[model samples]
Target chain A: MTVSDIQKLLNAKVLSCNEKLNMEVTNAFASDMMSDCLAFAKDANVLITGLCNPQVMRTAELLDIECIIFIKGKEPTDSMITLAQNNGICVLMSEYCMFETAGILFKTGEIGGATVGC
Target chain B: MAADNTIKLHYDVPNDDFTRAGEASSDLKGKLKQMGISPDAIRKVSIALYEGEINMVIHANGGYIDAEISENGLKLVLCDTGPGINDIVQATQAGFSTALEQTRMLGFGAGMGLPNMLQNTDDMIIDSIVGVGTTITMFIKM
Candidate 1:
């Protein structure tokens, strides 16, 4: 699925790198733990998290994570947005909770990275 | 400065600024990119280095990383002199952490730092003395 689809599915706001909304994403992983994503995330996967911080962006850069969706209405800070912009990672904020966000995306074939192979 | 075929570098990590934890790893990533290193090697090294940097910041008060890059391989030594670990075995296990509550709130202290470093590097070694310091050496061959 493309990044734009995720934005529309969760009614998320694109905080940065809107130009890459058309970029395709294969799967996603939802967690508040940054280390989990660091270990399991592959390039171009969507990283969904409730923890909003700059370290999250730093992890995204290391793993080449294509998109990040902050669920439960958690918005990223100004510094986080700057990090995302500099790294060319798409940042989005969803009003839905983690379960709802992951469920909707799962129903649409954007399954979890853990459930499937990376 | 003394070697023609190797690039040796050092980075000082300060614990006073948690937000600045990944600077050294990020700088190394950029330098590796400029050197045209394989994407796979770059990914593995960057992830391992970043985790080490974060560990130093969160647990050791502060430390420094000395790196040597060449055709042979990449070697990194991270040293910190703050409350050395008494049990290296437990510390290396996943899901084992001694971080403060505030550190976890910032999305760290999952106890995955050492494990991540182990997973990404081909060779790893850890040395520590209680009340003295901790040093970690890792190598990834190209």
Candidate 2:
């Protein structure tokens, strides 16, 4: 599915880098820990994270995550938005919590992106 | 410049600027992309190096990051003079951290930094002296 589709399914608002809305994303990885994302994440197209911080954007840059969905109604800071724009990573905000968002995405066809363990 | 076909880059990590902690890693990431390195290698090196960069800012005040990109692999050396770790083994264990609450709130200090570095790279060596400082060297085959 395209990032735009995920945004529509979750009713998420685009927080930054609107240019990538049409980018296709086949898998999503959810994590609050950047280390887990770093160590085990392989080619995860979308990152569903509860943590809202600059490091999340940094993690996205390293893993080449095309899109980031901030769950639990979290909003991106101005710097985070700038970072996302500069790196060409799309940022989205969802009102649903991490569990609900992951469930919705998984039920909708997004597979588990990363491996099971670190 | 030192050896055949090896591109070397260095950056002085600033201690006072937490926001700029990962600049060196980011710069190196961009350089690797420009050089047409494999995406998998670039991702591993970038993430592993960034974790070390963050560790330097949070624990060691600041440090120096040296990146040597050779034809076969990438070498990263991060050196810091801050108070060194007491136990190297314990520090590498998951979920063991000595970082302040402020650092954790910023999405770090979970004690997975070293482990993450080790996992991403092909080889990693960490040397520390309790009263002196610490230096970590890592290599990733491209």
DockQ for model 2 equals: 0.62
> Where in model 1 is the C-alpha error above 4 Å?
A110-118, B1-3
Candidate 2 chain B weakest ten by summed lDDT: B1-10
Per-residue alpha-carbon lDDT of candidate 1 for residues B1-142, written as tens digits (9 for 90 to 100): 2369899999999976788888898899899989999989998998899998888888888889999997888999999997999899999999999998898898888898999999999999999998998999999976
Q: Per-residue CA lDDT of candidate 2, range A32-85, in tens?
A: 888778766776878999999888998888788889999999998899899989
Question: lDDT tens string, model 1, A2-106?
Answer: 999889888899999999999988878887888777777664478889998889898888877879999888988898899899999999999999889888998
Model 2 misplaced regions, further than 4 Å:
A116-118, B1-4
The models' CA-based lDDT, in order, is 0.87, 0.87
Docking class of 1: medium
Please give the range of 10 consecutive residues that has the lowest summed lDDT in model 1 chain A: A109-118
